[model samples]
Target: MEAGKHDRGRSGASIPGRFVAEAGLTVPRTVLIVSPYFPPSNLACVHRARHLANHLPAAGWTPIILCVDDRFYEQDPDPLLGSLVSPELEIVRVPALHARMTRRFGIGDLSLRAWSALSSRAADLLSARRIDAVLITGSPFYPMLMSRWIEPKFGVPVVLDFQDPWVSAWGADQKPLSKAGLSHQLALRLEGPALRKARFVTSVSTRQNEELAARHSWLDASRMAALPIGGDPGDLDLLRAMPDIRRSRLDPAMINLSYVGTALPRSHGLFRVLFKGLAEMRARQPGLAARLRLHFIGTSNQANDSETFSILPLAEAEGVADLVAEIPRRLAYAEALGLMARSHGLLLVGSDEAHYTASKIYPALLTKRPYLSLFHRLSSAHALLAAAGGGIHFSFTDANGLAGLPQDIAAGLERLALDPASLGQPRQDHLEPFSARAIAGSYAAIFDGLR
Candidate 1:
């Protein structure tokens, strides 16, 4: 069988009968989307795959999602997110192996344990149905490695979607072979074969695609594509239906600034600088600082862990503990969006890594609430915010260098709080390309081209 060729079934066609006629439309192809995170599991990794699974049918392709059973995730499931899945979509939930003993060695996740089950299930699906393409998305990057196993045996073209860099250099500046660095090294060795075998590679940002391409000369530039994980309208719909939860929680007199999402190791430096700047601002103008409430919702050092990490201690050390509210627990996706919408302003903090693109940017913009974005000047987020306008950009380092970082962030915060109108309305044209529906169209085009 050819790499892109599909075997014809008894009907003398390459597509399965189930996908043939849906609502009077002929769905010509089926793409198996394999990911550990999907609806009910509200991990950030789930959104892109969920969006594609939800919207792909409109583009002449039916998405059959292969995801881990809900028991695999430690986080509370968001049943509301399940509404995003189309009734026509086929979701295969495979049970994962979870041994609590393996966690100390960093091998607890279902991605590692479910490989055997995943591979078996995938092979069965390919044999039973005329799956036109296989798309594996990641963070639990091992799923991408399945391409090496699937492509050769089934002769299906696999497309690897990278939501985050597989081999990250986020904290490699000082310690070249740090724990993360060593993990990245292992990933580099494992990813080589899968990347080479993949029909095409898609990343959330252009910089990530270029970086991956540069690292692998065997990968053609044309084979790499940038597909951002834009916001889903369904998320907004659910959020809009919920009561104004923020009204009861937040002080009406204060200027509320909310940051929703986890704080990874790469973002420690940015948070340090932010807290210090907030402290300095408080010292300079205590009255103004009293009016500001910085809320960190769904922000934690680790997922599903109850322990509070460095952020709270750092805030205390910087003397802004009184001004900061740290909600270490993760919120439901809709609740988080509603919180962002109700805030006086939104806060976006990117990692020091140059390729870091805050996936939250789209939803943040969609909130229509003014945002203050702080990121490394070299990061993709910097360019995105600059291009979109309506947001204040504070560089991690300035002309005066690190010494001026605190003042710069402080000034940006003041501007965001005092002159909210200056941020203006986000241009809808700039946001259209990042919509989940629009992104699915791009993926459909790639799948079509490969066929």
Candidate 2:
């Protein structure tokens, strides 16, 4: 809700809603952040809300996080992540249909389970508080429909933040009656109306914004912004303080290179190229290959499912299984960061989609260790690495572009195995623009303009 000239606190004295450091403008506004997956749930998408809530206060906005209660979450809760949320932040958790009940009906998406609950709570908050804006983020893309629903009743503007594409041809090959295809069809029907009424839109990459614009011709270029979910240096600090958390998965005796995150189904081709390169390295430089160990941790997005392995099968097919270890179960957020922190080097593989930007690059950059990224030439991650002077990036255009990948991967592996320091550290100056604080300022700027 938009604040008046000032707002009254619990003591009933007037408090400035917003304080501009330079212009001395005191226009405090309240923004409700509707994110289904939040802290303790430990899904990576939660950080977008977590970091924003912590820093938005400085930008003259008081953020209220509206999330589903962690108890109803399908993923295992990580207590360490809960500790990282700011004490000052206002978080309201709402109940959702329990996953067990929903799972029986083949309806496990959090957005579907919690949409009515979120809608009810959001209406209550808007009615009670002086809310100026509503920012709805999605993985549970259904909540974004509230953008159209809330504004009409509450008289507040809404912004839709896309962490991933709501509508895409990603699973087009699936039978139309299948769950994935049905969801895609539903998205096709729903996304346009949900977006049409939004005050503005924002995404993590320029390509996503561009795609949204192309799909909905009415969306103007100025109505959208592309900003990465930058890393929080405080996360590293908190990670260091938690000694008992499983920190490093890399072997100290080996030349450890780690890739920590879910290996998407679309990323199979990228892995094929990478493993083929490793196979070549093993054949050409047996001694160095023996010493090098590549760790693909948390390759499965599903929690507590160790039986299914994404990278292991690929590695075996490429005949480099000995050099690669695939841990399919998801890891705690801090543990993932710790693995990157302790690694001799990091491995970043991008998706087949040119528009896909790996937001994990921000945290990887914060680790200060060299990262060798295999991405499309147009991927924002490639540009980010270049701008930050972080590490080596191998960009491919098409099937033909990947023809040299095996050789490139072989060379990169050899270099990291022998003279890792030659890659040099990422420049901190260039990285400053991508801090969590700066990202909040950018979000605030968009919020400030909508009013």
Candidate 3:
């Protein structure tokens, strides 16, 4: 139970290691993981990756990470991801290639899109190393394209860990270079033969599993599985112990709703609607508006600047601009969870990019914090929260048929406040199952089935 000892000798009835032990899968099923963003990357996807990689060792599957060195990514390197690894788990950070490090955020075929060769070269390292299955986490689905080529040539099985549904799911939200677009079409066309040939496909949610199954009708469809992001029991305990935002709690009866991600542009962004709705609600319900305060817990850097998202002027216009507070990324994770423990609920904004997975919701579950989701109706994050057995969900289209907008949202908050089961009550089923050990166990099952 120290800093890195999340998995002591196996606990009973868990998924990740238990499944592996039951199947008699022993050390070194050998998985080579390709993640463009790894530890020190600090993006939320690595939480799940680190969790899965750390736990599967008990089942005897060795996970090796192949990631772009953080020096190459747009943000400063966060050394945290590497800390999540247990000594027994093998890991590798591929050195920076010419364009890969320089072209972190470029959207189209310009920089990030054209950097496939960089990943291709890095993937070749797998040949010298021992690897049984190729595992890939995507969203720079660009690198996984390299896996398609490398796995086939190297004779390794492939498992695509989809943090978000790629291609079609993004297409549903009208993303640039979509499955309908020529460039994305090219990636998919080249990827199809490689994709169909893979042993298994997995995801963080059923919404995405279904999206993949629909697009790849020729594949067995059942190969897709859901290994959701789970809360670390350690993080849960640590967060409950974290100091309350003393000033935030001092405000009389204020509802501290939290959002824990980077800001993005206005097109499909939920912060825009959230602020506007709060403004409208203020005009109608003075008490609720005045009682609400939003504490955002991720750095708003030059990269996710609010000016580009048009949040500044809109926020000012709504007279609720000051409600947005920024916290550093390093302290953000645990502090945000701590705030969720003390607050009435959490709030999430959709990114301009669709198929973007919001890691905010999972931690909310951990804290037993109910949340109000203001996302596009079809968003995987929204779908998961609505059906995940707790919380209130509202979408741009009233997609879940939750009545009217500001009125619907205001009423929803009132309902959450009134429900004896929701307010300040702990989550009976906290998200421990999504633990890395649990996830690695999930993969071991698929591995045993396929192997």
Clashes of each: 0, 7, 9
In model 2, the clashing pairs are 1-130, 1-131, 1-132, 2-131, 2-132, 17-28, 18-28
State the lDDT of candidate 2 residue by residue for 1-451, as single tens digits.
1111111233543223484343564445888999999988888889899888888887778888888887789889988887888665677787788889989999999978887788888998899887888999987789998878788888899999988888865856568999999988888899899998899998888998888888889998998999888888888875675675465466678999999888987788999999999999889999989999999888887678887888988999999899998888888888888888889899999888878888788888888888788988888888878777657778898888876789988898888778878889888888777889999999989998986
Residue 106's lDDT within candidate 3 is 38
Candidate ranking (TM-score, best to worst): 2, 1, 3
Clashing pairs in 1: none
In candidate 1, stretches whose alpha carbon ends up further than 4 angstroms from where it belongs are 1-27, 101-106, 171-182, 243-247, 301-303, 396-403
lDDT of 1 at 79: 77
Give candidate 3 misplaced runs (Cα > 4 Å).
Answer: 1-27, 80-82, 98-130, 168-188, 236-254, 262-277, 283-285, 297-307, 310-344, 349-357, 374-390, 393-403, 414-426, 430-433
For all predicted structures, in order, the TM-scores are 0.88, 0.94, 0.73
What is the lDDT of every predicted structure here?
A: 0.79, 0.84, 0.58
In terms of TM-score, the best-performing candidate is 2
Off by over 4 Å in 2: 1-27, 244-248
